[model samples]
Target: MASQPIKSDGGSSSYYLIPNGARDLLDLIEHKRMEFGIGNIFKACYRLGEKDGTSKRYDLNKIIFFAQRELARLPKDA
Candidate 1:
């Protein structure tokens, strides 16, 4: 919605901007009881496709990296 300003207050970044109806990253993290690369993936998604100093490409790259890490950490069938 771009209604809230970017506030870096303390631990939770609940004030970060997102689409009006979109699910918040904090909600996802809490619901998922996130462990390992999930948090980083959420972090990257939180700011993805925004004009926050870093471009959307940067966030995409971060998401890709975190996803790759998570995928790698999972058990693989032989």
Candidate 2:
């Protein structure tokens, strides 16, 4: 799910809300980061249903870190 990324006022964090189908991606990333003590930053990922205005939520620090990790792992050739 595509989402609008948000940043922190302190300039040290960020956040994004992905749709329900994307929850698995969040879970997978969280699992990978757990051993490194990085999961603490994630508050939770929730879907309020189609009737609700929004369907996803992410903590600033967690999402920001995840995004950085993804960027770092991108193939140099790509």
Candidate 3:
């Protein structure tokens, strides 16, 4: 999805709102794990969204949900 530019606090920013937030966040988590390894999934996910300019639009509930789900999937030794 294309990001929308929004104005807030007298500033402008762009963000993409996931059509299916839960599924998109889960897919993003898995993709990051594969590409970046399991160092810090939550932070990685946040950073990825920031880099992609989509973090602001990601649903807070879905973020928490996928973060916990991804953390549980991490290897104990990782």
Candidate 4:
């Protein structure tokens, strides 16, 4: 039988396909540092920073990561 991917209740899919013979210590390092603390519902807008080292008004928009509901379906109340 073929192996199936695992689906989490959070609506995300994950799978482990590494071979048993693989050996690489550096592979353990996180690519983007495991995200925690704040959730993924936030956006990263890069605008001109003030001289006082503070983020200025949002002059641009970029969706680093959007909410699942926003990506999945329309708002029910709308």
Q: What are the lDDT scores of the predictions, listed in order?
A: 0.70, 0.46, 0.50, 0.34
**What's the residue-level lDDT of 66 in candidate 2?**
68
1-78 in candidate 2: lDDT tens per residue?
Answer: 114545568655523443345556457455444433234333333222222443334344455676577567769884
Pitting candidate 1 against candidate 2, the one with the higher lDDT is: 1
Give the higher-TM-score candidate: 2 or 3: 3
TM-score of 3: 0.28
- TM-scores for every candidate against the unseen true structure: 0.55, 0.27, 0.28, 0.16
- lDDT tens digits, residue span 17-56, model 4: 4335545422321322323211222223322342244444
Give one digit per residue, the lDDT tens place, for model 3 in 2-73.
245455565543333333444655565554343333334455555655656546446444556666776788
Residue 13, candidate 3: alpha-carbon lDDT: 35
TM-score of 4: 0.16
Q: State the weakest 10-residue window (summed lDDT) of model 4.
A: 34-43
How many clashing pairs per prediction, in order?
Answer: 0, 1, 0, 0
Error of 2 at 17 (Å): 18
Pairs that clash in candidate 1:
none
Most accurate candidate by TM-score: 1
Over 1-78, each residue of candidate 1 has an lDDT whose tens digit, in order, gives: 124466675776754434355477766566546775778777877777774588889988888888888788878961
